[model samples]
Target: MAREVFDLSFSNGFARTLHERALGDIEQDYPWQSLEPSRYPPLLLARARVGWTENAFNEFCTAAAMGQMLQALVQARAPLDLIGMASRFAIDEVLHIELCARMAMRLGGGAPIHYDPEDIVFALDPSLTPLERSNELVVRLCCVGEALSFPLLSGAMRSASHPLSRSILETIVRDEAHHGKFGFLYLDWIRAELRPAERDRLGKAARQTLDAYRSLWERGPSHVVAGVTSEGFLLEHVRELGWMEASAYAELARVTIEESVRAPLARAGIML
Candidate 1:
């Protein structure tokens, strides 16, 4: 399939009800009107909008990945509770997608982002056993991705001066607390079935996933617009608008990978 521009295609009537049901009373209102996108530099707003759009796309991918996990769990005859949790996780990711896209819109509308629908979700190897397949997906999505996301988002939340940005990050980090733990839960449930060789393979797969994540941080400097480095005022605006400086962001990513990701996986017997 050809790539298409990303769109939420949201509806206020039915969607509002669905959002309430999925998020319950915890879903609070954001003061979207208070956001002054014009206060920031146009280039800065442009960069932020693009980042938010990317975030929305990533959330879409995560929701799809969670759906795949839910199906795999059902096929593997995983515990009923685990399957139910996976279903809930998918709903959470979908909510995140809307939040991210709306954040982009608040920043002066979402930037153009084209994505291949079929290629958005990660593709697992068909040759793996049913149990192994579930393990790989959990490790890739939850263990590494969600685990690293928690601390990074927490840092972002702390750094966020804007109320809307802080609220969104806080909500995401709250849900991610469960998401980050899901892999170990799944692993514990299936530990008896995994052999030494299978564990080794999972470790290797996890390492590759970590490498991909690290690469994103390594590309951080490229995202910085021209001349922002020499302008202290512009840098402060970036921080106030809820973005970490490039060096700090990269350093945090490294620490998060070690403390939040690698250590947890090692404890789960899936060392990377």
Candidate 2:
């Protein structure tokens, strides 16, 4: 017989409230103000230009994926509460795409906002059951993707010379944090319902999903930024922000996955 599932209403409510609160905190704290973009070297400015465009492209991909995943969840007849939370998250992601695009343009970079066909194809594959799809989606979207993104953005925000870029990154970080929390909570809720064998399977799947995206957080675009900036100053700035140190970032990944993804799952008796 199949294992019984529990209602995720409370988890959904907690996630919604957390996201809402994060949105408000972003409006209030606005942590990006410390970086004065104009103070950076000219080469650094050029790098920021490229970075903004790349950032916009990444956000567009993320938003597109989240929208598709949310649709899949709704189609699977996931609890209404979870569906509603996902709906709001999808909308926020869409707005983030637009916001990042605008920020790129404002920072003197042309928008490179092409959506990859593969992103949709991977997101909407009909081969997997709903639970399988959700697990894959959360592992990639929340745990690996958003989990790594926060620290990267925070680092960029710290090194940013442009005030607007700093502000934009700060806002984006707030949303990503909440998204990470949702991934954690979902893992917790699902782990409780899984049998030992299933837990092991999920753990392996989670680790594989995470390992697949390891390159995304590998290193700064040092060479690329060097070319764009015409000097190594931007690269140095990135180094100052700790992007050059793989050890530190690797540790960050380990802790983020452990605390925000693995630990919660383990506590709920999930193998991952």
Candidate 3:
């Protein structure tokens, strides 16, 4: 017999919140570092700086998505525990911004990052029903987006030599594990009620997200950011920094989806 994904009896027992012990205080536990400025090359430092900016932006995006999801859940009368978990997840994203920024400053210094406020808000077509909109958003952002972080960060951890970076990265990996699991669980909870059309909607969304990801990865490191194009950078020495080379990262991403993500979705009858 297959295991149940969503606990139908969740309300019977109290739902657990985030592991406060593991997380600790963002600043106190994950202390900032002051490494020798000369340790990293100019390009490497520049890349780290870019990482800070990108991760900061991603932090806000994820937080914004959390708010939208919470609103949708309330409108749909979702479990209070689930909403509580999401609220906490939004806080985690904030810590991630600090972690990323610290890494950048340690590497070199933070780059100028200007983000438009409008870009942070979530929007869906007027036609989408509450359930439909929420499902698609969760499927795209959490299921696909946060799910991918598992493999990507795991791969990085394996190659990462720096003790401080690895420690911080592990927290993100731990937190994202729950995020990905929630996506699958939520989908499973709604699985029996889903019409063929709803499944198709989610299936299409997943496919599109995966395709965009593959396309982005296949484009090489030059496609990663501006003024930073070390194509095979992560193949050797840079692996010390906890990232993969262009070819390896792309292949890893594709393989991980095929194994972990795509297979599971197909089994769940999502047709991805």
Best-matching candidate per lDDT: 1
Tens-digit lDDT string for candidate 3 (67-153): 788788777666677667766788778667667766766666667766565656556777998878778777877778778777887
Q: Per-residue lDDT for 1-272 in model 1, tens only?
A: 79888888847798778777866644357766667888987778888999889889998998998888888888888899988887889888877887888889889888887888888777888887777778888889899889888888888878787887878887888888899888888888888777889889999999988887866468444244553654334665776666776767788898898888888778778889
Q: Which stretches of candidate 3 lie over 4 Å from their true place?
A: 1-28, 219-237
* Model 2 poorest 10 in a row by lDDT: 1-10
Tens-digit lDDT track of model 2 for 1-272: 33322111225577767765644544335434454446667665566556656666667667777887686676667667666776767657655654565554444545333443564424334676787677667656776567666765665556554455556666677777777666666665565566677567667766766677566446443333432333345455554322333444555655666665666556656555
Q: Candidate 1 — which pairs collide?
A: none
Q: Pick the candidate with the highest TM-score.
A: 1
- Candidate lDDT values, in order: 0.81, 0.59, 0.69
Comparing candidate 2 with candidate 3, which one achieves the higher lDDT? 3
List ranges where model 1 is wrong by over 4 Å: 11-16, 24-28, 216-233
Model 1 sits at a Cα RMSD from the real structure of 3.1
Q: Using TM-score as the measure, what is the rank order of every candidate, best first?
A: 1, 3, 2
Question: In candidate 3, where is summed lDDT lowest over 10 consecutive residues?
Answer: 2-11
Sliding window of 10 residues with minimal summed lDDT for model 1: 222-231
Q: Is candidate 1 or candidate 2 better by TM-score?
A: 1
